[model samples]
Target: MPRTNLNDILIFMAVVDAGSFIAGGEALGLSRSAAGKAVIRLEDRLGARLLNRTTRTLSLTDEGRVFYDRGLQILASVDEAEASVAGQSGMPRGILRLTAPDAFGRLVILPLLEEYLRAWPDIQVEMSFTDRVADIVEEGFDLAIRIGATASDTRLVSRAIAAYRTRLCATPSYLAERGEPRDIADLAAHDCLIFASRTRRHGWRFRGKGSSWIKAQGRSRLRLDSGEAIRDAALAGLGIALLPDFLVADDLAAGRLRHVLPDLETDDAKIIMLYPDKHLLEPRIHRFVDLMVEALGRERPDARSSP
Candidate 1:
């Protein structure tokens, strides 16, 4: 059988990645009609309907998904071949897809991403900032940054990037009104802001007088899914909150919130990076991971400083 045009496959993949024929064509400097025709030709050659298209959206059929995965492997091989020839001089070019927790993405990752973009002129990034844990492989994300989460999937590689101390805090008014919790048992009487989500609820745990740890028996009257929202609720004097230092350091330094039970020790909120477990990582993936490790492998002195 005659071979299918490789350019058609590239165009189809581009369209899927861009999520629209027009945008995909624009990426390759082709007209929408031309890109659409290329995809149709490829589909005809393969004798399969690849994409389910509507007026405003596009999604892959099962065959398209499989084909796309194979295409990714093919591209990886091509990239590896090019890198072998070019060695260290090879420039990283392609879209880097990333997902990170909402508040942390805005507060921390965005700055690093800005630097990454500056360092690599040919690279582009697509980001999803959400608290919801995403299936990195299924979602086609190159990397995911998570807080206090673990990867259970055997197909993913998880690396711990940083750890931040957590503090139980409340506004002065709330503390004054409710009285400060002198002991862990007192938490039962105070209103606590809990981090609850559809998948799981975050519970506060602290080291006891001995080596044992105990869960805080706080009365959770308000539950929020966002770390920043919990901080806001604490600032509003609604309740006491358990939050990472990075998110509430300024509030504590500015006297907006007071730390509760300063002597008590809490578990650190670990920052982890997750990606597919590929033997040979693309330059974009390895380079970004290296950047993250270099920047956040250890706690930076400025991480807790008030801005």
Candidate 2:
């Protein structure tokens, strides 16, 4: 068998990552015909078909999946080797893979990405936004921005970027129609928007001056997976929603949504930066994480500051 070129492996990785030849070609700056031909050459050398192509979609064959899993490792090694040699110039280059929560990614990270892109034109980024927890090490991600507590992984490192807390809120119209709940027990009679079914069963918990408590029962009107959906429901006067305060801060300030049981505290979830545990942080990943922290510093509330 002929030795495979790095360019061919790169093309295969791009196709798997993008899940479309046309999109991969656009990303890699190759013509569709050229990209297809490169894959064909790669498969020819390997003596196995890598992709099952269709008019509308692309799928990885059994061998293709195996190659993809291994290909990422090969590419990562190449990237690291290049970075090591390129260290002489002291500038970070190559693509940085990152992940973040859906709504947070859309509202916060997307705005800041342009700055990173402009500051280091040579360094590219592939950002994935999803609510699902990602295995940074296994997925070959350089970094991940997560809310709530960071996951426990021996192969990963975590740093708190900012401290944030959740709040209970409802549209003024909703409150006007349903009246305010003065205490947790009052929630049993009111419509509350819940994020998880578990939250519905367990209820809300809070701690504050002169009180530490939990509310185990509420009349749930809607259960949503997205934070934005809960906030919107509250704004639309559908029900009271317990959501991250950062998400509804503008609404609270604009008088569209009113804070409920202000004296009774709610759960606090920290925003954190998670990355692979490494002996020496690659200059690119280090700089990217630092830039993200700085950007968060500017956007977070004064009350949410953490050392």
Candidate 3:
């Protein structure tokens, strides 16, 4: 077999990462035809197909997935080598892969990202925004922003970059129709919007009568995975929702949603940055994490400062 060209491999990786040939080509300064031909040449050299392509979508085949995973390992090694050589002058160049929850990523992370990009003009970022909990190591993410950090995973290290509180809130119209819930037990009588996922479920918890934390039991006739959707439901007079204050603060201020059970204190949500344990962390990842803590920890008003 002929020796594989590194440039061809890079082009293939770019195509896989960008999800389309045109966009991949755009990222690497290559024409669509040139990028397509480069991938074809790579596949021919390896005698294996990498991507499964259709008119509307593109996916990695089984072999492609394996190759992509190994490619990430190779890229990490390259990054590590580059970091060693560049030392203090690295300046956080190259693409930084990051993941965050959809609503928070958009509202909070994007603003910090704008500043990070402006300050570090040499660096590029690729972000995945979704509500699903991502497997950081398996997914090859350099950093992940998650709420409610317990740091159970031994393979990863987590740091609390910022904090936030959750609030039980409902629209005034809904409260008027259903009657206000004065205490924790009253929640059982009203419709509650739940945030649930395959692996996780959200329940309302507050500082109990005597200071111990207690979970509020409520009927979840309506449930949704997205935080923004849950807030919308509460705003539309569907039900009361327990949501992060950052999500509902504007609504509460605007009188679209009224805070419920203000006397009982709900648990604060910790905004955590999780990354795999590494002997030598890349400068890009280190700088980005610092940027998050600096920007979100101080600039974000919704971030829990005291608690």
TM-score top scorer: 3
Stretches of model 2 off by over 4 angstroms after superposition: 5-73, 82-90, 197-203, 209-216, 298-307
What is the lDDT for 18 in model 3?
90
Arrange candidates by lDDT, highest first: which order? 1, 3, 2
Against the reference, the lDDT scores of all candidates come to: 0.87, 0.77, 0.83
Q: How close is candidate 2 to the true structure, as a TM-score?
A: 0.71
Candidate 1 global TM-score: 0.74
Candidate 1 stretches with Cα past 4 Å from truth are 1-90, 299-307
- Each candidate structure's TM-score, on Cα atoms with residue i matched to residue i, is 0.74, 0.71, 0.77
Question: Candidate 3: which stretches are off by over 4 Å?
Answer: 5-75, 84-89, 298-307
Pull out the clashing pairs in model 3: 163-304
lDDT of 3 by residue, 1-307 (tens): 5689888888999998799999999999999999999989988888899988899778998988898878877876787798887764466767789998899999999998998899888677889998888888898788888887443776777777677888889999998999998788999999999988887787888897688989888999998888888988998899999888789899889988999988778888878788887665788898887788787675332222110
RMSD of each predicted structure: 6.3, 5.9, 5.6
Q: Write the per-residue lDDT of candidate 2 for residues 1-307, one digit (tens) a residue.
A: 5478879888887877788888888789998887888899999988899999888889999999999878765755666776676663457766788898788888888888888888887677889987666767777688888776543566777777776778889988888899999988888888988765322222567774477566537888687766787788888889988878679889999999899998877877678777776666666786787788887754342121111
Structure candidate 2, residue pairs in collision: none
